[model samples]
Target: MEEYEIAIIGGGPAGIMAAIAASQNSSSVVLLEKNSSLGRKFLLTGGGRCNITNQKPIKKLLNIYPQKNFLKHSFFTFTNEMLLSLFQDKGLNFIEEDEGRIFPMSEKSSDVLDILTDYLDDVVITYNFEVSSITDDFIINDKIKADKIILATGGITYPQTGCNIKNYSLTSQPLTDIKYGLVPLITKEDLSDIAGITLYDVVISYKKSKVKGNVLFSHVGLTGPGIINLSNEISQGLDYNLLENDPDFDIEIAIDLCPDFTREDLKEKFTNDFQLKGKTMLKNYLKLFLTNNFIDFFLAQSDLDGEIQLSKINKKSKNRLIENLKRFAFEITDFNRDLSKVTIGGVDLDNINPKTMESTLIPNLYFAGEVLDLHGPTGGYNLKIAFSTGYLAGLSASEK
Candidate 1:
């Protein structure tokens, strides 16, 4: 039987960090991965650039977690700064973006994983060795024995990157309630016609919840960060069904095609324009205020001829146009179908010790990454959780 002080599973960010941390604490560490190379998911993160972490403080970082207590416990020891410093000390320097998102100076996730590999020289790693099962005493490597085990296996997302479906199987730890977060939403419109067109500075709202920012039409649905933030709320049981099925599902999006102008200001401008070219059709008059296609559609909906004089426009028609500008609604039918961007659920947080990430049900057991039901938005927050929790698990395993 081959014996070691620590055994870490899954060589993603968490597993790599655990191996480095555990080995530094005078424990013989072994990291097991099924992929031919380490950090397959890491390479794909942030669209291959890898948003390593956010420049947010510890308190701010804690706010990003869906479950606060879990993050509070795990982050006490290994923090966002500590993780950045660790990488920096290892020669993987990082820079922050406009939104405080941190990325490697090299602009490559591959560089981050390379640094980890260099740091884990003393830690044994077995690639292409998919972990079939785990027991208290050994990892069953040709009947080999391991002293301590750490399961850093990720969740159901990105199955192509070697996600273990059996991660939740045979677990004595309770799973945390998981649901989709930070994904796009599908709408009833045939957005494919305007798929490449982006709507900027628009107010998108449902019920009392609303966000005014940039959004883009996709072939499948609506996207962009604004929509993604809303998608999380919807997937986590926000009643978007009312916006999907109800014929009266009127989601009022104030497309301030000109948000810079108030209604009164717009009305004044229209009055002056009508005075200058009262003979011009309403469509020609409004063409300056809207896209050509939108103006045509608005005119058609208002039951007005494009070439009609502005003097002939009735109060009812003007009010209707104003209403259309202020309250454009789109029916939403479904949520994002991209499974890779979602973490539906994981190990329940109640049964686990947040401080050490240890299972109260089993001795010498630990969990990290998406398996624990902790996730954040599309930022680097999710990966940060994986690193912090893994550090706690490795430290606790070494102590035991």
Candidate 2:
């Protein structure tokens, strides 16, 4: 067997960081990946321009993680400042966006990957080798053995990115369920005919829940940063209600097209437009507020005539219009988990020592990245978690 001081599995951001951190401190490090090349998914992050990390303060960043406790110790070990320095030292500077979202200075994920790969020049890498099993005795053919192992295999999202099934199903310590995020949502409405209709400045909210954000309607369903945040909540509800076959865990999603305007303001605007341009059709008049197709559809659904004169408008029609604008509700019939952003449940956090990311059940075994039960909303939160955890995992493994 080809024995080494460290054996790191997966070549995504977390795996790569583990390899780099471990190799920088000690020699005899081997990074194993099942893909033809490293950073397969990394290349497609942030719409091909990877969002590296958030520029938010450490305290604020902690709030982003659903499992914040899992990150508590790791953050103290390798802070975001450390992460920034690591990249900047390798010539990959980051720039902050509107909401403090940090992206590569070159605005290219490839640059981020190149820097990591370049920094880990001394670490040996084995590509196209799927890890079927891992044991304390030794790793199987494609021979590699080590004093410690770090599993950084990612979650179920973007399965096409060469993420192996075995990563979530390692014979030694398997993971739980995985969910998707940062992907388009499937709505109850038959949006197949109206795909591509983009409604801007809309407020989407889940009734009586803390979930709410901007919503965009698409042919597949609804999508936006807001919907992805709600997926985690909805997935948990489903898991708890699994036994109730007829359980209706449906969520009522509301859309406010003109969130800034009150019902009276909208009514007054409609009345003013009607009296000012009495000859113009209602469809033609409302086109300025929304797209023509959407305005036509809204009017059609309200059973209101567009060409009718201002004098013909009544109280009932005006009330219906205001109601539609203020509260447009859609029943979430079924949720598609295939396109979620992060894997929700994983190798339970309780089983791993948060301080070192080392497995409490199995000594010398560590887990990092999406393989652990930690995820956050889009905005460079997930990547931050990966770096912090992987750094701790690498340091802990190397010390042992």
Candidate 3:
């Protein structure tokens, strides 16, 4: 039987960082991975480019997470700036894209993984070591004994990447109800007519939650950052089993095609355009405000004649057009779980020490990454959480 001072399970970003941190403290560390190699899911982030972290300020960054106060310590401890700086010092160049998203200059997620793994020279990395059991004495699989254990096993999303929640044996700690997070919504409306069209800076709202970003028209429904973010907001407390069993189970969402302008504003614009392009067809006039394909679908949905002249449009038809543009309503029936970016729930936050990432219910047992109930929106927020919490957990575990 082999022994070590620290055993970090699940070699995703969190486990990898935990092993690195523990090894830096001169503690013998072994990183146990279920997969053949490390970072299988990590390479899939940001479409393989890897949006490492957001460059937003701490205050603004904190607002993204649902549990802001709980993450305050970890965010302050290992900030986005610090994460970027760590790579920068190690000769990694990065580029900042839209919405302050930072990506490696090489635009390869493998490069980011390389930097992380390079730091774990002193740590033992055991592949295909799925831990079957963990005793209270801190022994794993009856083979490895450790003073402390860091469960960096990620949430159940990409199971092929080795995220099997069924394999987890920490029944002593309370695991919160899990749901799909940052998943795309499957709309009831068939948007096949304008499937490839993307609306930029559009507003998608459900109840009081309104999200503004790009929305993509898919064959099945709406997608892209705008709808995905709104899905995250409305998906909370949703019963997935109920959603699966009841086909009628769904939530209604409203999309503002022209969010920058109000209905009255759109009416005014239409009035002016009608005066200038009086002889122009209604569909031709709509081209100024919307795409050709979307205009066809919009006109058909509104039961309006696209062949009619702009000047011939009546007050009722014009009002309906403006209203639809301002508030296009649809029903969201289900989520695209296959493309879900993150898992929403994990071990309840109440049972974990936010500052140290240690389990309050179990001594010398720590949790990090998606295994905890912490998650943020798309664009590197979740990755930062993984890295930050992993660092804190490893640092705390290495101490006496």
Worst 10 residues of 3 by lDDT: 240-249
**Would you list the clashing residue pairs of candidate 1?**
174-348, 175-347, 175-348, 176-346, 176-347, 176-348, 178-344, 178-345, 179-344
Please give, for residues 1-400, the per-residue lDDT of candidate 1 as tens digits: 6677777888988888878778878548888888998988878888788898877777887786668776887777887778887779977888888667999988998887787789888888888978776665555555446777778888766778887557676355666454556667777766665675666667666666566667777888788766765666556554322112322223423344566677777677767776787788877777666666456545664566777788787777766666666666667776665544657467877777887777787777777777777888767888888888888888888777
Provide TM-scores for the models: 0.82, 0.88, 0.94
Give the candidate order by descending TM-score: 3, 2, 1
List model 2 lDDT by residue over 1-400, tens digit each.
7888888988998999888888878888999888999999888888789988888888888888778877988887888788888778867788889778998879999988888888788899999988887766657444787778898988867778876445665746645555444555566767766566777667766645445465666776877676767666666555432212322446676777777899889988888876787777667766766766677667776678877766567879878877887877767766554555666667878789998889898888899988887888888888888888988898888877
User: Model 1 off-target regions past 4 Å?
Assistant: 136-144, 238-324
- Give the number of the best model, judged by lDDT: 3
Between 1 and 2, whose TM-score is larger? 2
Off by over 4 Å in 3: 167-169, 240-248
Compared with the true structure, model 1 gives a TM-score of 0.82
Candidate 1's displacement at residue 276, Å, is 7.4
Off by over 4 Å in 2: 136-142, 171-176, 192-194, 210-213, 240-252, 262-281, 284-293, 331-338
How well is each residue in 1-400 modelled by candidate 3, as lDDT tens digits?
8998889999999898888777878549999998899999999999999988888898998998889999999888778877787688889999999888889999999999999998999999999998888988988888999888899998878788888766444546776667778888787878887888998888888888899999998888878998887777776746552212422346788888887798878878888988898899988887777877788888888889999998999999999888888888888888876777888778889989998998888888999898888999988898988988998888888874
Instruction: Flag the better candidate by TM-score, 1 or 3.
Output: 3
What does candidate 2 score on TM?
0.88
